[model samples]
Target chain A: MTEKDLIDACKRKNRQAQRLLYDRFSPVMMGVCRRYIKDPMEAEDVLVEGFFKVLTKIGMYNGDGSFEGWIRRIIINEALMHLRKNNQFKYAEEINPNLDYTEEPTVLDEIAAEEILNLLDEMPPGYRAVFNLYVVEGYKHREIADELGISINTSKSQLILAKQRMEELVKKRLGRHEI
Target chain B: MKTEKNISTLFQKGAERISVQPSGQAWQRLESRLEKEERRGRVVVMRWVASAAAMLVLVAAIWLWSASMQQHNFAILDAAPPQNLEDLENVDGCEPYCLVLKARAELPAYYANPVEKRN
Candidate 1:
């Protein structure tokens, strides 16, 4: 079925259509969840909850935007909610003064996609959330601040720290791989 | 040396390529939750229907009783003086003295011989 047809069927609560939608989106949504939640099981839980919402709230979709984008927003919000529920944002707001800001930027061209995800997984939850929102998800600092309930400056600073931390992690992984 | 733009582009590209297959059980859990929600929704609707039905029955019973009371009041008002205890039983709001008067009028011999009857 066409995407439109699939959505209409889902809106009608068609079980087959719902399952198809889940099968199609769960992997990508799981990837999105993992960027914010490091634990595979927790990420899976968020993925399931997110899909449940998508299916149940399908009627609210007014066809104003791409369905996939709408679903992505829901999944991202769910991940943020999970983090907030766990009090992960407390560490995200703390400014680490001792971070090496002057470290040379390492070439990330040679890194595999899996390695990049692993690097993201290793960062602090707060930094990872900010980084995922700002860089990967293309969210503005203001939007990230609102979603994370932090100041704009905090979002900006966390992005910077997250990048620095990513560089360090990439360098360490590269060094280990080269040896 | 990578600029901020280059770093973001790299990570964004990686994120685009990243897709992990969720465990098979994830769909099962979601399906069960959806079913439960559906069942709950049905239950809520049924509860509302039952409550409405009960309210309707109570209203109908009240209306019928009031209608019968009105009819009985009209009969009592139009009828002649009470000829028997059964007739007096339908006389609503009668004072005790009024009931005594009704009893004496309806059954004179019974009241007249009350003292001898007591003996």
Candidate 2:
């Protein structure tokens, strides 16, 4: 069935249609959730909640944008809410201005998705959240500030700190020849 | 050393390409929650319908009662009193005979017979 047809059936609360939609989108959405949530189980929880919302609130989709993009936004918001509930954004105001940028430039292309996620896991929650919001999610510093309840400068600092920490992680990984 | 932007871009691209299937039981968990939510939604709708039905019943009952009361009042007004009773209503300190006359004027003849105590 076409996406429109599937969406229509799901809106009608058709179980078959709901299953089809979940089967189609859950993997990618789980990946999206995982970027923000370190725990696989928590990421799965967010994914499930996100899909539930996507199905239940499908009527609000006005066809103004890509359906996948709409789903992505919902998943991202769910992940953010999970983070907020866990107080991951609490330290967003602790700005460290003296971030080190001296690490030798490692080839980013050489790292796998798992390694990137591992690097993210090593960073503080606030730094990781800011980095994901600003970089992966493409939110501007102002938007990130609004989302994390921090100032724009804090968002910027957090992103810088996240990157510095990622570089250190990558350098250590390179030393171990894991890449 | 890779610049922050490069790393960010790399991470974004890599994350986009990666895919991991959910655990086998994940779908079951989600389906169960959806069913629970659906049940809750149905309960809300049922409650609303029941409330509306009760309100409609109350309004109908009130309407029927008021209509019956109006019909009874109209029947009383339509019943013509004896012509002399209009004048009797103005009588002051109604004497027993006047009261008997007023009863005779307001009630039908068959009912009024009991009011006549004087010869």
Candidate 3:
């Protein structure tokens, strides 16, 4: 069936259509959830919750843009809400302006995706969130600040600190691998 | 600096390929929540309908009661004695004395037919 047909059936509250929608979008939406939430179980919870929201609010979709984009926005917002509920932004702090990493930077292609997630796991919750929002989600500092309820300066600082910490983790991993 | 951009690229690329399958129980939980919300919404609609029905009944009862009260008032008016005694002034063979006796109720039995005395 066409996506429009599936969406219409969903609006009519058909269970089969709902299941089809979930099966179609859950994988990509799950990946989106995992980028923000750390625990697999919690990430799954977020994914389910996010998908539930998408189904419930499907009537609001007016074909203004891609359906996937609309669903992605809902899932990302749900992840951010989960983080906010956990007080992740309370620990966000301003980075020192003079801080600099002059050492030879590690190349990212050398690290596997699993290694990247493991490195991300070692960082603080606030820094990780800011990094995910700024770098991965492409949110401006103002938007990040508004979403996380932090100052623009704090958002900038969190990104800097997150990147610096990731670089440190990457260097250590590279050293151990070399040894 | 180049590494910073590359780090972003690495995550973006990984995000594109990473897909962890959710547990089986996830759909069950979501379905249960959706059902609960649907039931709640139905309950709210039912409550509103019931309230409106009750209000309509109350208004109808009040209207019926007021209409019956007005009908009762009309019945009382229909049964009441006439207020205008001047209407009896034009009666045949009823003199001023007869009218006075009838009005006072003090006339003797022999004078009960005042019109006969006038004859």
Candidate 4:
């Protein structure tokens, strides 16, 4: 069915349409959730809850923006909520001014997507959240601060820490591949 | 040496390209949750409907009780004899006794005035 038809069927609470929508969006949404939530099981839980919300609250979508974008926002919010509920953001505001940025610049183009996700998973939860928000999601520092309830400077610092950590991880992975 | 912008672009592109198939049971779990929520919603609506019906019954009962009381009061007033000056004067000093006298006045003629009937 067309996206419009699928959405209309979902609005009518058609079960089959809801299943098709889930099949279409869950993979991408799961990937989005996994970036913020480290545990695979927890990420899947968040994904399920997000899709449930989408199917149930489908009536609120006024067709103003891209449907996928709207769904992505809801899933992202759910992942953020899971983090907040677990007090994961408690230590996210700590500014690590002593973080080392000294590293040999390495080529990042050859790294696979799965390897990138692994790099994200290796980072601390706070750094991962900030990095995914600022880098992947294209959110401004101010918006990231508001979403994660941290100050703008904290958001900026977290991004720097996350980047340095990701670079280190990438370098480590490249060294292993070269060996 | 990749620039900071290049790293950001790489991560963003990687994220966009990434899509992992969820576990096979993911859909089943979500379907069950949706059904549970639907059942919960139905229960909530039923509770609201029951509460409204109960309120309607309570209001109707109150209305009927008050209406019956008004009718009984009017019947008593109609059957009782006209108030006398003595009964009206005694009302302030002995309101309850006056009310009792008013009720006694509704008795049969043979039992009407205890003092005069005995004589």
Candidate 5:
């Protein structure tokens, strides 16, 4: 059945429909979960909780943007929740916004997803979380600020610094002349 | 199929994604939760009903109490009360009244006040 068809059936609370919906979305949502967190088990746990929240709040999905976007948001929140539960969010002192990261766009495209995740793993929990959330999910600075309990300026400066740090590491890993 | 394929690759790189196996366990748990929720719904309704009943009883009791108090007050007003004869005769001599003598009773007392008594 088409996704819309499945969603319609799920809205009616059909058991088969609910199960089918979960099967289709869980894997990708799980991937999204893993990005901000390290442990597979905890990521899976968040995925389950996120999926449950989505199921309960599905009626709130107004079909304005994307259904995937809606679910992606729930998974991101779940990851943040897990981070908070484990006391893993590290809030760095605010960096000066003037720090230059002009060439990050080209540098970012060159790095593999795996290497990025590795650098993310090494990041202080707070910085890594803000970085992944802003860069990967395309969340706005205001959004990161609101979610992470930091200011918009803080989010921007952090993203800039995270990119600068990630670039340095990627250059170190790939050697300077390769790119 | 590029979009679908991209999604598949992204998922594959992360780990083996759990193919959603429809375990009866999931349904069973859902059913139990829903049942519990249903029970909670009933309990909420029952609570509202109980509150409404309590409010109604309180209103009724207050109404009866006020009505009884009004009736008692009316009874006091409807029956007679003692008034000073001097004042009573001086103003309006409308009702028969009696008072115990404060001192020795004088045989007969009569007066015609020329000035209006300031009430």
Candidate 6:
């Protein structure tokens, strides 16, 4: 069925439509939730909350843009809310973009999910949350500020620090000697 | 190195992307919960409507009763204008019933219009 048709059916509170929606996008959204939260269990919990919010707030989606994008934004907000409750935001006033830059190789070519999780697991909670929000989730600094209730400058600096930390972890795993 | 290539793979996790949803029992529980919530919502709405209707009926009944009371009061006033207005005004300590000599006096032109003069 078309995306609009599915959206309409869901709006009508049809179970089949809801199931189809879950089947189609749960994995993608779960992947997003998992990145922000290190615990798979917690990620699943966030996904559930996000799904419930989407169902209740479906009326607000006006079909002006991509439906998936709308849902994705909701899921991202769900994750951020959970983190905010836990006091997991990292704030740095200004980030030297150069300081966060790392001359590292791409690990995506061969790294497994377990390996990536392992690298993520090593970081502290605040760093982990910021890293997932900035790089993995693709939220801009202003958007992150609004979501996390922090300043834009802080968002940029935190992202820079997160990248600097992630760079070291990825390099250590990949065992690369030179830049 | 500083290439943006690995970012996609980091997020996607490729074929490992799997979803775990609730079981049949859990889904049934959720459905039951939702059903209860919907029923509660309906009851609340019904109660509000019923209360509003009752208030409307009460206001209409009170208004109708008040109008009837006013009409009755007006009837009583019309039925016995003389008794109720008895001695309402006294001229020289006498009830103004001139025929019985209670207050017989020369009437002024305004009070005794020529058209109403008793010949």
Two-chain DockQ for model 1 = 0.26
- The residue-by-residue lDDT of candidate 1 on B1-119, one tens digit each, is 43332457778877865789999899999999999999999999999999999999999999999999999989967978655556556556756747777666767776666655463
Question: Model 6, which residues run further than 4 Å from truth?
Answer: A90-102, A107-114, A174-179, B1-40, B67-119
User: Between prediction 3 and prediction 5, which has the larger TM-score?
Assistant: 3
Q: Which pairs of residues collide in candidate 1? A: none
Residue B31's lDDT within candidate 3 is 92
DockQ class, candidate 3: acceptable
Off by over 4 Å in 1: A90-111, A175-179, B1-5, B73-119
> Each model's TM-score, in the order given?
0.78, 0.78, 0.75, 0.73, 0.60, 0.69
- Whichever of 2 and 5 has more lDDT, that candidate is 2
Check candidate 2 and list the clashing pairs. A104-B1, A105-B1, A105-B2, A106-B2
Instruction: Evaluate model 5: give its lDDT.
Output: 0.66
DockQ for every prediction shown = 0.26, 0.25, 0.24, 0.26, 0.04, 0.14
Candidate 6 iRMS, in Å?
Answer: 5.7
* Tens-place lDDT digits, model 2, residues A111-162: 6777777777788777788878777778998998887777887877778877
lDDT of 2: 0.79
lDDT of each: 0.84, 0.79, 0.78, 0.83, 0.66, 0.68
TM-score of chain A of 3: 0.86
Error of 2 at A131 (Å): 1.8
Could you tell me the C-alpha RMSD of candidate 4 in Å?
A: 7.9
Give the distance in Å from residue B71's predicted Cα in candidate 3 to where it truly belongs: 5.1
- TM-score of predicted model 2? 0.78
* Candidate 5: tens digits of C-alpha lDDT, residues A1-179: 98788778877667688777777787677667766777766767677677777776777877788898888888788899889889986666778877764643322213455654565566667767776776567678888989987789888888776666655665566554322
- Residue A89 CA error for candidate 1 (Å)? 2.8
Q: What is the per-residue lDDT of model 6 for residues A1-179, given as tens digits with 9 covering 90 to 100?
A: 99989999988878788768877887778776766777777777787778777876787889888888899889878887887787776565576544545434454455566666677778776667666666656667788778777777777777667666777787777765233
Candidate with top lDDT is 1
The residue pairs found clashing in candidate 3 are: none
